[model samples]
Target: DERLGLVQMAIDEHTWLASEAREGETVELLVKSHPHLSIVHFTLNGADDVLRYRKWCWSGPMFRMITMGRCGDTEAVVARACRDGADLDAGHFIMGPQMPDISSSAARSALAREDIAAAALLLHPEVLLWCREHKVWQASTEPLRRDERLKHTNRPSGTPQQPC
Candidate 1:
């Protein structure tokens, strides 16, 4: 009966979230509305419904959401996952390989497409460091370094280049 109860609860939550929740309400608020069920779903079942809803609502994966970066929804989802003790790094690792390689070209391509979020994420300092440390792509560092140098050079003598 307990197991059945959980299943029913999950179904109910899914239905409400899918059909009844307000347009701008975040997944975190919805999940937090039923903490025990959320914990069980996230911890025991990998929060499949949440992931599914992310895909359905955003039309992409978490990484894609991050790349899109239009809405703060992706960040909120990540924060909630971290608060709930989800393996954020694991999600990153799983999604990493599918991402465009951390290179200037990739960043430029994203920019050309007007995907500023994707470009920013690709050229992020941490991502640049990660690529260098992990040898994901040794060449990624050069363009970033060049860009930094250009930033400094372009600044007036008395003005410091703003950090990204």
Candidate 2:
């Protein structure tokens, strides 16, 4: 029944659209708590709003989707970590609650991974409060947006994430 319950929760979570105020509040919380990372609640609706100062949060620079309720399992938990700032290449380092890589060689590998992630999540409760990000982006014909932040980063400096 636990798995079924999780499925239902995920369904419910995805059904709700995050509102502008809710998204701003989530960004504010993340910025206040995590100075090392950046936060952006990018969405189609806010595209015309100039990414108002409070609407975006970043300490120096860094940045997320998926709601907290859907984070019932480890993969989602780890995805949160990856979205927050924990690099997937960083290895088994704890991101919060812990667990899985299904393609692993052993049968129990997935379970073992899950337990680790779940434990990490429990260890750091704040991660649960971290904003759920729709990490994936949707593209449009809008002129390429520019940001000075990416000068040193791999992504093209002039184009933030839109079509040129």
Candidate 3:
């Protein structure tokens, strides 16, 4: 399976990144060679430009490249990547547990607690949808559920809030 092979290569590259420019070039080459390679999961150092490879998974190509060629636009890229290939149910791959639909409720919650910027780097669908739904850019706030809880608290209206 070329897609599975691509996933393995991404993982291997993350494990051993020698030169900065060279690593970037390597990743770029990967993208070019495998247009369907879309999923990339990884860690990173403080410097944004440096990515500490974790693990990656991808699908083939899609009707359009939702996130291709744009530096710093990982979510679109990943979603587009997932959309690229023929559908592969979770059971289809030998990779670890079914890849979470980054677009689901659970993933969204996890992303909220995570650094928004870092989550954005991963661009998992759950996080992206949450960000979009919340209109996160104008003002940063806790997730909608949290906000709702705060709005409907049963505490005395004028009482100073007690520690939980």
TM-score per model over all chains: 0.19, 0.19, 0.17
**Candidates by lDDT, descending order:** 1, 3, 2
lDDT of 2 by residue, 82-151 (tens): 5666443432232232222222122123223434354334322222112111101112222112232122
lDDT of each: 0.37, 0.31, 0.35
Instruction: Say which prediction, candidate 1 or candidate 3, comes out ahead on TM-score.
Output: 1
Regions of candidate 3 where Cα sits further than 4 Å from its true position? 1-103, 121-133, 136-142, 145-164
Better of 2 and 3 by TM-score: 2
List model 1 lDDT by residue over 50-92, tens digit each.
3434432332223222222223244545555556555545433
Local accuracy of candidate 3 as per-residue lDDT tens digits, 1-164: 11222233335446663333222445567778988877442222111111122112322221111111223434433344255552334322112222323333333444556546645655544435444454433233345454553443333232221211
How far in Å is the alpha carbon of 152 misplaced in model 2?
53
lDDT of 1 at 124: 50
